[model samples]
Target: MNTNKSGPQENIDLGNSKVVNIRDKFDNKTKEILAKRVGYLCSNPDCKNTTSGPHTDPKLTINIGVAAHITAASPGGPRYDSSLTPSQRRDSSNGIWLCQNCSKLIDSDTNYYSKDLLQGWKHNAENHAKQLIERELNQGWATTLPEYFESLISLELTTSPPIGRNIGQSSDGQFWLVLWDSRNAKYQWSKITEKYAEQELQSVCKYRNVTNWQDLFEK
Candidate 1:
């Protein structure tokens, strides 16, 4: 007779005190939440590695982020928690987003990565993403031409849309134009004078949309 009590199959025990072929799997919803919550970046503070990027195939993207459990999903595994229910084991709150390398490293060095420490990492990563989004929103529109260009690139990696608009005079006092792309929401800007930039931006709002050039300056 199998003495092992029934539970999630991932940590099942065979007869005669033998535990074999255990597995713990996170549901698709849990996986999605873990990845999205951390902005698809590795949760390691020192690494801060990008988990997804443009792939060699132009039409494809690569994702390397892993949702690793804070406590092992199965018995006899690193940081294994026999006390947790199967549902609790697979919860998003019990997971952390990590790069492939960091995932292996944590599991191998279980002594250093306690459940509490992994929870702290998760908290920090999510808070970091939230702060970046807040900064982008609070920045409003860029006031100067140079500031506009810089802000556009700086915000591309964060959760914000990274859309910025600016109209200002340059050092030479030429009219500066910065437009947001309606199709893709990309920030488009040019250092050339107003006449040259009109053709480049190809804006539908060119002549009919403006009250006055002087009134367009973004603060």
Candidate 2:
């Protein structure tokens, strides 16, 4: 019925009795940090929709993003870890920004959206935000798709590669490809024409069955 700075306080009815459901929800500050870190984008790589936009009222803004918990905020919830304390549950590190749909999707399916997977998504999303900021500071505009593939190749070499493939890029501003071998943790890359980069990216996307090529850059 009443809420405080700590978290939400509510009562739930069960049969003939009422019980309190005190979830360790993120505070306003924590939610802001999570949203800012991801540049207000949904952390789901496949669904990187912008979560905030202008409203008809100049004084107001609309937000469709949710600061979701990586681990459940309460008992018997999806990915709930009893080992975590209430403070830990409410911490920013345990939160991920997502659209309303994705927030519900993750909670509904715990097996496919494991804690590790969500963590990965958070890391990638934050890194993407950082890169975007850095790119704007270093250059005037966002990196072109080909340049993005080139950076992916560089990222692959520095970290874990995908599976069963070797990748490369070209200097002629043509194209690039990157492969990740999760088993061996090895990466192979080369330079090719821009046309080849598109083809290779399509091939890799098909292999991984992912709609977004940016998902491949996940470490």
Candidate 3:
């Protein structure tokens, strides 16, 4: 008889690997850990998509990155940056918990948040809201959009009387998914920001590889 010694998974060893370019630390460990903390999804107030990976256009950790440090490091630190040399780096408070899209928004402008909103958001992330891009911005009249909108105008929303996520028959008598499109309501994934059942997502959860919400919810 013969046996082989156990070896660690390649992803788990990312913290010590020398291949920085080839191996993404965040994907290997940091993402795994942070996802657990933030419920394996975007931490935005209303958005609720499970995060498959971590991002570092802003660095969260030195290696096995999860949260990006808003401030750049010194010349010879874990991630040296010439551009950051002149400017003072910010502390963790300056950093925001963002998904890939939100991270881009932050980089696009120094004044990303409204002055009144920014101060309140910084005071506590719980008070903040996830801002969508122009395309998905809450607006009116789109020639091409989801068909479910039409059904929503007429269909009133109702929950299953607070089973688990139902939160108990909303205080407003009933909880219904309102179709903003007001054109077609056959099927539309509403509230991309808030955490939702896997099935609630359209193509967004393409990687989920699950047949329906039960796949993740039963867990």
Candidate 4:
């Protein structure tokens, strides 16, 4: 039996009341830019809710809304580009407005950590971001599967081309393809797929003999 309890007051205040710990003024600008870019709504195409909720914990670490950086400014990233004005370099094309769940989805995948999605989202959201800066931003948006696909395509294919087919998503609806990139460690696409996507999923599952997914398609 557990006697001790974690009260709501037990949580430490990080000084800011915002869901995401956006402290830096630059990051705040980034957030504002994203909010404008995404129209202050959730980025999932299927979810029309305002992005005014708590984001579940990602990495199973802490419970907070993780504001996703469309282009992660991590090590070995394209952060040193000399082609743009400093402001353009620090603009909304470099990021996105994903709710916590979608944020987690972004974190759990490589596409998020790649250039493909970053550039794709940039191209996709360019108009919106432009309007956002112009103060003509709307407040209605949701992330869609096409955005996901375009992002994946934005990846900088390695010198050695990455292995994996553009097959469809899983049926029980866990993954997008039979194997989440047989070339890399397995990670699944949480979003569901349609009939065409299902056919693609089965073909790859059978071709790769993805044990579980292959059997699922046979039926």
**Maximum-lDDT candidate:** 2
Q: In model 4, where do residues sit more than 4 Å from their true spots?
A: 1-26, 46-48, 53-66, 76-90, 112-114, 118-219
- How many pairs of residues collide in each model? 0, 14, 21, 11
- Lowest-lDDT window of 10 residues in candidate 2? 139-148
Q: Total clashes, candidate 4?
A: 11
Ranking by TM-score: 2, 1, 4, 3
Q: Candidate 2, residue 103: CA error in Å? A: 0.5
Question: Per-residue lDDT tens digits of candidate 1, residues 126-189?
Answer: 8777655544764532222242232221212223343545443555556555655444544444
lDDT per residue for candidate 4 within 1-219, as digits (tens), equals 986576675265656453233221236767766665665655544442366544375434322333465544433333333454445545656566656776666566565445565455545554444444443222321222332332221111233334333443333433343223345433233343556455555544555556554354344
Give the per-residue lDDT digits (tens) of candidate 2, residues 1-219. 876565423343464333126588999999999999999999999999999999999999999999999999888788999899899999999999999999999988899999999999999898899767855664432332323444453333334434544444344343434444455443334456656555566766776676875465543
Candidate 4 lowest-lDDT run of ten: 147-156
TM-score of 2: 0.61
Listed in order, each prediction's TM-score against the native is 0.55, 0.61, 0.26, 0.33
Each model's lDDT comes to 0.67, 0.75, 0.35, 0.46
Query: Against the true structure, candidate 3 has what lDDT?
Result: 0.35
Ranked candidates, highest lDDT first: 2, 1, 4, 3
> Candidate 3, 179: how far from true, in Å?
32
Which regions of candidate 2 fall more than 4 Å away from where they truly are? 1-20, 140-219
Q: Write one digit per residue (lDDT tens) for candidate 3, span 1-219.
A: 766456645444456352342311233344344444444445544544455544565654322213443432333333333453232233333233446665444345544443234334333342222222212443432233332222222211243222112111122333234333333322223243223322344332244554553333333
